[model samples]
Target: MPTTKKESLQFGLMMCFGMVLFMTIYNLFLSGFIEAITLMEVIKEFIIGFLIALTLDIFLVGPGVKKIVSKLPIDKSKKINMVLAMSTLMVLAMALFMSVFGLAISYLHNGNEDNSLLKDYFSTFLKNFIVAYPLQLIVMGPLVRYLFIKFVLKIKCNCNEY
Candidate 1:
């Protein structure tokens, strides 16, 4: 079993990885197709909210979850599975966090209220959130974790023997 500190570190890394990957994917597709949110606008919004959600998940959410999970009677061999599960929870948690953060940021940046892209593309906004958030939870979180543990982690271990 990894130490608490190690697990915490791993979880933080995974959380950040998930957040950035999800944001990049969402921004790319939304900007390319939706036209409501431009590349620059996506970058700005992502910059403002991404770090906030990442920090929240890493410092606040991840550690709290670690404490809880530590108390569970699960086997140590299940660490990878546990990390994947926790990452999914973290994504869901951050989705709500980012949505609220996005709303607040939109209000602050473009106080024109009705003239913002959000107002112009309300349906697009809703679609993006509904689709992206769940997709992250379903695919990015667990699948990425699995790939990391299976492929990337294996490569790293093998390469370290050189």
Candidate 2:
């Protein structure tokens, strides 16, 4: 249990926001929100995307990319590599999540093959990925990480050492 009311509140808010964000993205491309998005579609897309992103992040970027980045001198290049690495990882994660989830939703909602809504949704997903990923990394990732870290540190400092 969270000791601080603020922590509990923030956790709840993050969850709510995340779900809303996910649903909004799904509707904008896949379903258009004329009807409720199905749970199966949501779960499929989220799981597939998350798995793809996690796998890519761990296997592709985690070791090889870091080693290459680590070789750079501690200067602007290093900073650039750090930013690049983080951004790339985040984008991949987001892409994977959006793709699987979007596909599932679009497939579920679309009635006719001629509609091609799923394909269009995929394209939109990629387009949105290109635009939104940088923003998420630059804004959401740093902000949330910093907040959580600071919150944890504050809690730790407040603890009575045995």
Candidate 3:
């Protein structure tokens, strides 16, 4: 959806902000930490998570998704087709990488005494993918696009231009 580099950066930042916020809260709730999580703790975790996610999304996942989607067999002329392909791959890649980041954070915060790192990583990846796929497609993707058009593009209605 972003035509220029500046627009791409803005779009990526907005997407990362919402996705990180939602995923952090969702993961904490899933891990049963929501009951004990303080606002300050949430804020701290969010800041860290947002930075990591934004970095990965911008430097790694964004370019990779574009490359992969360009190679896909879908009809590129159809904007929806290209959008869906890119979104799907982007979500998949981000969820995979971010799950590892999440697991590392969990290990650092709680310590993995059970020595089940591989198993835990798989579980975390699956859980993250399950939520992230739909959240990106159904919510964040559209919402960010709408916000970008409204604010970044500043596309005012013609009736108000008079």
Candidate 4:
């Protein structure tokens, strides 16, 4: 429930970071431990994942979250409530949009053309949604918002007076 473009951008940035971090952990847990021979590869994955996530966040999730929030019966005056609602909605939106994209990424990474993404897609989606919803709702959302509110949004630095 961002009322301004700046807030929307800030929210998107937060999600972008959260997604990149989450995806890195997911990717590592899936296959990186055995496959990665060096830390450089992990760093590369992180950078590439960050770029991909930022693009997806700004292009897909950010606007979609705003649209979904707009449809919900939310109280704009209640910041905490709005944050919770938006975080929940964002998790749903991410699950809906990013799951397939994640499948594609996995497909590319694994070089598995024989196995269809359709197979076990539901199970994968459910697992991802279940894991991500709690992480987003309980950890990343509040942490990011708290940091933004405490240090970024509420701070104003003015110098060199007239």
Which prediction has the highest TM-score against the true structure?
A: 3
Instruction: Give the least accurate 10-residue stretch of model 4, judged by summed lDDT.
Output: 153-162
RMSD of each: 5.7, 7.4, 2.7, 3.2
Model-by-model lDDT, in order? Answer: 0.60, 0.55, 0.89, 0.69
User: Where is the poorest 10-residue window by lDDT in model 2?
Assistant: 11-20
| Candidate 3: C-alpha lDDT | 0.89
TM-score (C-alpha) between model 3 and the true structure: 0.91
What does the lDDT read for residue 133 in candidate 1? 60
Better of 1 and 4 by TM-score: 4
Top candidate when judged by lDDT against the true structure = 3
Per-residue CA lDDT of model 2 for 109-137, tens digit only, reads 66446657657666857765765665556
lDDT of 1 at 148: 59
Q: Candidate 3 residues 1-162, lDDT tens each? A: 788888899999999999999999998888777777688988998999899989988899999889888888889999899879988898889898999888987787678979788999999999999999999999999999999988877743444678
Tell me model 2's lDDT, rounded to 2 decimals.
0.55
Give the Cα error of residue 99 in candidate 3, in Å: 0.6
For model 1, what is the C-alpha lDDT against the true structure? 0.60
Model 2 stretches with alpha carbons more than 4 Å out = 1-31, 34-80, 115-124, 160-162
Instruction: For residues 1-162, write the lDDT of model 1, one tens digit per residue.
Output: 224565545645654666565665564564353365567866766676657766886688766766766666667477576765555555555555565565565455445456665564454346446766666667765666676567656765798999
Model 1 TM-score relative to the real fold: 0.58
Off by over 4 Å in 3: 155-162
